[model samples]
Target chain A: MEQHMSEIVTAAFIVIGDEILSGRTKDKNIGHIADILTSVGVDLKEVRIVSDDEDAIIDAVNALRARYTYVFTSGGIGPTHDDITADSISKAFDLPCEHDVAAIELLRDYYKGRDIEFNEARQRMARMPKGATHIANPISIAPGFRIGNVHVMAGVPSIFRAMLDNVLPTLETGAKLISTTTPCPFGEGIISTPLGQIQKDNPEAIIGSYPKLAESGNFMTDIVVRARSEEVLERTTGAVRALVARLLTEQDTGQ
Target chain B: MEQHMSEIVTAAFIVIGDEILSGRTKDKNIGHIADILTSVGVDLKEVRIVSDDEDAIIDAVNALRARYTYVFTSGGIGPTHDDITADSISKAFDLPCEHDVAAIELLRDYYKGRDIEFNEARQRMARMPKGATHIANPISIAPGFRIGNVHVMAGVPSIFRAMLDNVLPTLETGAKLISTTTPCPFGEGIISTPLGQIQKDNPEAIIGSYPKLAESGNFMTDIVVRARSEEVLERTTGAVRALVARLLTEQDTGQ
Candidate 1:
């Protein structure tokens, strides 16, 4: 429940991977995080997909962290050569990257009795920026780190979800948006003028019109009205429905 | 064929729609475009998803277009009230959006004998930023347009694909990358130090070590070396193979 002017909590997502850009792998993380954030009332304002370059990661982290209330970065935290996100983040914030004792201990316990030796490469997963907190990954022992407003998570869909489960409880959320939809039988061209007027009238609401190309060779539009309060939502949607009816009547009468 | 030091052509994608942010519609266009661009030797450097708001879209278009060799925007070219991409793109470049005579004629021919009238809203698709050229869409009569280096396409995946097919041939491409991979029995962390040295030795080649979690719970790494020329790729990858063998032999001998 929120008032007319609830403060909005904005977030930005940075998807870091070369596999995505090279078309080797299609990303399955962005939509999952967005759906979760939307349900929790945080506005997913912007999203950026950048490759596994240290300078590129650092630049995006600095810029997005400064711009949004929360910055969520997925990927580039593995034990590989391209896993330079932690070091880049450390450079961006001018912090020292150190091996986290707790993370190292966790990895040791997980890998205990494994045939492969716990070599230097496996140990790289424990290194994080100094003064940062860990985001737990149940699927894999490679814990993601958070410094300031930036939350780092794994690129793998399963591990990222687990880390998010450990992180979502800590952040502050804004008012959840309530929405109403009015379907229009007429084409979008027939409804645009009235919809525009309704949008102008409701300055507090966000209006979006989605068109559907039906298989029956008919086109339809679904106008969605979203607002913080149910009262505003109903008022805007009511106006839209009425305007559509009026326009249809006039078109029928040849006026 | 390019030598070791070929110029890389970079591109940025801007997805303009609120549907993506709200998590109502999952975007299917980014990966499609990225795969095509990569095969043609253009680096898909960055991708940004912004809402249909004018200021947000304009800011992103200007920033991405200025930074990358080319920018492709998808969505907000329909007849609905919230379809504001054309106007925003015009404002981004400080140009006027007008109803292009050619586009209007195309629309008229397309909608001829159709059940719905070609009203103002449908005709709005013909309105693009001044000096913009059309990108043909065979699926739908509404055409995407281009201004300077920014190419605007439809949000629907099928129509967007049709428009991209028409646009890709006209753009210039860089040298197609040549790559080779060397598999390592050890983890990524074990090889990162040596890989970093290899990367330093071959500045023109990009060395990326990707780790895979084996079924036996041990992690193995695959080192991929990318360069503009086959000789550089093979040379870097050869060094990586020798380094892995030496490391393995030393560990087996308990050195």
Candidate 2:
């Protein structure tokens, strides 16, 4: 229902962790989430990495949920004291956070044969906002919950990926974007003006220029064009290729 | 002036690029910036990665600049159509963006003997918010600028690093946080209760539990304690280590 007839589906990502902000952990989840969203034709509009503070979590969740089609959050859902994402999400939605009967039953059964005890701390993982649906975690028995437009998942990369795999199939996706990248040996300085013209002319396609440093430290620009329609993508890339060819000819002929 | 007598200088980082959001480029700048900020005693409170759009850039810059002591931005300063960060920052601060005389001079001199032309597009790199001071880029002659507390830098990792090096010493810094980590053999479920107690006892320290996936797919937790005072850090880490030891003993006794 979030997606209408339009070919645009957008999502925002929230990374909640003190370890990431403290420089103790390098985030591997953002790129994985971006790649997964892109694969499903979801445009990742913005990403915010906030520390594991309750106020910060609540503020981000509320703000992003109202803006994007879906807001995905990772980290701070564990049994540890610092894990406050679930509670914060509940507070953000004005829902009563309590133990979910199904989650408690699942965790109890999961730990029945295990050596670890089903203690109070472990039970904390079962708590969720009322009216929330479970996003099953294949790697871990404790599930991530989906309340409103926000999908809360575990911080562990493997667990995040597993939860996303389960959640992606259910969300509305846009038309897959068609893209082409043309590599130009010239610097961005040489191609930027014409590239801007191409972008202005082809408003349907999203044109971007990325500069990379070669092994020899010379600048090389890659022109990437993306569109929902194959015809538009082809036309835009053709114009870009023609421009690059003309620039190369001028360089070679000393024009 | 921003630090005053407080020992808590904070910053927010904004990453401006579409390549990063499209999954075509995995961001190397966030972690590098986080590490650099931590080393300089600035707590990196938040990080937002937005696409190369004018409104997105302006919003992120304005919101973060108001909240944090410093706002550092990377990307969208190159000589390309997609490079709109400089203009966005100017608009965010309501400053008139004009060509910086020193930047134009430096770029012109740098391109004097070079093969690349110092065209209008190349000169676009010299534009900055009025009254902004340059943040030197040693690798590339084009400079990043610091307007008020916001520092704008390039997206290329090397160039970003060089610009940050030039900017870091000029900012106000906080007291360095002292930290210690203890590896826990038990899962977070086993350690969470006592870890919570340890955290409650040490109100001054920031305690965090991170879960890692071992080669055998089992969860391993690392208990980290951080504080501005070395004494508090030591005391908190000692309590965490003792809790781990007690849990290990309980497991061995099967009690």
Q: Which 10 successive residues of model 1 chain B have the least lDDT summed?
A: B1-10
Question: What C-alpha lDDT, on a 0 to 100 scale, does residue A97 get in candidate 1?
Answer: 89
C-alpha local distance difference test of each model:
0.84, 0.89
Which candidate number would show the highest TM-score if scored against the true structure?
A: 2
- Return the DockQ of model 1: 0.47
Candidate 1: where are CA atoms >4 Å away? A1-5, A113-116, A181-186, A216-218, A239-255, B1-5, B180-201, B211-223, B236-255
**Which residue pairs clash in candidate 2?**
none
What is the per-residue lDDT of model 2 for residues A90-113, given as tens digits with 9 covering 90 to 100?
A: 999999999999999999888875
CA-only RMSD, every prediction: 3.9, 2.2
TM-score, A chain, model 2: 0.96
**Each model's fnat?**
0.65, 0.81
Using lDDT, give the best candidate's number.
2
Q: Per-prediction DockQ, in order?
A: 0.47, 0.65
Q: Backbone clashes per model, in order?
A: 2, 0
lDDT of 2: 0.89
